[model samples]
Target: MTVKDLRIELTSRVVMAQILPFGLLILILFGLAISPDLVVVGDARRPVIEEIAPGLFWLTVLLSALMALGRAFALEADDGNLDALRMAGLDPAGVFLGKALAVTVQLVAVETVLGFGAFVVFGAPVARPGLLAATVLLATVGITLAGTLYAALAAGLRVRDTLVPLLVLPVLAPVLLGATQASRDALFADPGVPGWSWAGLLAVFSLLYLGVGMLAFGPLLEES
Candidate 1:
């Protein structure tokens, strides 16, 4: 199931061509808004944008993920594929995992592009590669899990285009907060902040949503 969904995502022109460019454009717009001008600090100087780059990067990612979620389920809903999958007796949990994993892979690719854009456009440097990687992994998992669940819930709705974001974004506040803090610490090596602790929060968030999606997806699939 995972492989099938991933193949669809890889070959889909909308996912490959449109979604990625949208994410990059958001990053570029953020760079323009923040201005990469260095400001004086206690003993040195840092780009004003660097201070906020982590948040900006993650914001871009979240917006992009919303679009991806819409596209993923829209394809299924529009093509009557959801009903077909239900009739085929595929395990709902398996289907949920497959879709979530595929979305995660897509978001990872988007994040990679946005990461490079952040470095070049925001002048942010990575000071702790390990922490940054952990943050991205855990946050991405959490985002995809919760997003997949809500996307399914909203799949049958006429307002799903507007509803998914309204349903999913509020629930993802912790993820956005944790990812930003952890990424900032990773990029700046903030001595006062415990980036690992924020990463742990993200891990917990991912696990909690994973269980929820696994249990609830079956029912949601039936209703949708």
Candidate 2:
């Protein structure tokens, strides 16, 4: 498929599968932020928002990532749309890119909502907005590629519904650790040497998964 055409098709499905949950995750985070215990307990340390919020933020992001992965191909598989896409000459790489792009957009949306909520509920400083934004982008892109690839592997299988999370989470251990820690520093903690270092790791992850997904997706998506 041409890049433009593939992107359009990918965007349509991604919005359906990825965006809604991302939106909900932020709302959930917002609710959690108001929890007197969560915010108040961390209150004394004068902790940054990351220390205060990264736990919740990462939890929501993790769940939302799984949700996106779970739905990645099932919707298409159910309607026999998967077959149509391949038969229509959709490039496997294009398909992966399009889907990842959509998920990335959703991730960004979640970050936006979370950003607003963080300020409103926690009164977190918006200092280093650029760094914070970069952290969000890194987190979202990593989730998108990792989840998309795993989703491709599990598509149309009975085990897929449960297996996506099981498979993706273990593989994403490093990402979760690095992204969470890095984000915490940028958002809440002092952002020591480890903070900047973690940020670099997040970038490496984005590139790693982007490459892996692009190469592996074509094979994985072929009708078995």
Candidate 3:
């Protein structure tokens, strides 16, 4: 089931269209908006690009995740395949896992590109390689799971485009906060606390959403 979902999502042009170019656009926009300024001290000059790359990277992920999830289910709804799946006796939990897995894969790809953009465009260095990698993993999982769940909730709505963002962004606040802070700590030296702690919080968020989706998806699909 997961493999089928992966194949469908990987082959979708929409995924490629949104993942790289859109993310690069966001990175460039952020760079233009937040250009580093020169500050002089004791005849020495430095370019100060504040610790904002992390937040901007996460923001790109949030926006892209919304688009990916919307298009994924939109296709299912448009083709009437969602109902067909429900009647086809596949476990709703499996379906949810498949969708979540696909979204996670797309998001990870976007995040990788965004991470590189942050490095080259924003000058955010990898201060803690291991911690940074873990933060990326946990944060992506949390965002993807939460996005997938709300996407299902708004799957049948007429104005789902607007409704899904409303439902998703608010719930994603904790994820954005944790991911941004963790990324910042990982991209800079001596952040005062271990980034792994924030990764743990993100892990909790992912588990909570995963459990909810597994329990609610079956009933949600039936009612939708």
Candidate 4:
């Protein structure tokens, strides 16, 4: 089922169509706005990229992921494919997992490009490369899982485009905070401050949503 979902998204290439250009646009806009210009004080100069990089990276990801997630169930609804799946008797949990897996894959790809773009454009060093990678992986899973869940909740609604973000972003406050702080820690923390705790929070959120989605998706899909 996961493979089927992945194939559909990849073959259609619509998910990538939404993620790549929008993600790149964010990176370019932020890069231009921030500019990494030097600030002068007492005959010393410093770039502000470090100050903005963490928030900028996460913000770009949030916006781009939002755009992608809003369309998660839309493909099914728009094409009358949801009925096809229901008729096929596919397990609703499997359907949810499949959709989430496809979204997660798309998000991870977007993040990979955005990560490099942040480092290069913002001049933010990967202070802890391994920790940064782990944070991204865990945070992405949490985000995609929760986003897919909420997107489904808003499915078949005329206002879902607006409602999806409204529903998902508030619930993702912890994810935004955890991922941003963890990314900040990974990119700029003092040598002694531990980053594992934030990554753990992301993991817990991902697992919690995974459980909820597995249990709730069947009922939710039935209703839709």
Q: Kindly list the per-residue Cα lDDT of model 3 for residues 71-162, writing each as its tens digit.
A: 77787788778878877888888888888888788878888877776676765557788888999999899988888888998885689899
Q: What value does the lDDT take at residue 50 in candidate 4? A: 56
- TM-score, model 3 to reference: 0.90
Full candidate order by lDDT, most accurate first: 1, 4, 3, 2
lDDT per residue for candidate 4 within 1-224, as digits (tens), equals 97766675775476677678788788878766655352112212243555567777888898888877776677788877888888999898998899888877878888888887766666576679888889999988888899988898888879999999899989999998889889888987776787879999999999999999989999888863
Please say which candidate is ahead in TM-score: 1 or 3: 1
Error of 2 at 192 (Å): 4.9
Give every collision pair in model 4: none
Candidate 1 clashing pairs, residues 3+ apart or interchain: none
RMSD of each candidate? 2.8, 3.7, 3.3, 3.1
What lDDT score belongs to each candidate, Candidate 1 first? 0.85, 0.69, 0.79, 0.80
Candidate 2 lDDT score relative to the true structure:
0.69
Off by over 4 Å in 4: 34-47
- Candidate No. with top lDDT: 1
For every model shown, what is its TM-score relative to the native structure? 0.92, 0.80, 0.90, 0.90
Off by over 4 Å in 2: 1-35, 39-52, 189-192
Clashes of 4: 0
Q: What is the lDDT of residue 101 in candidate 3?
A: 87
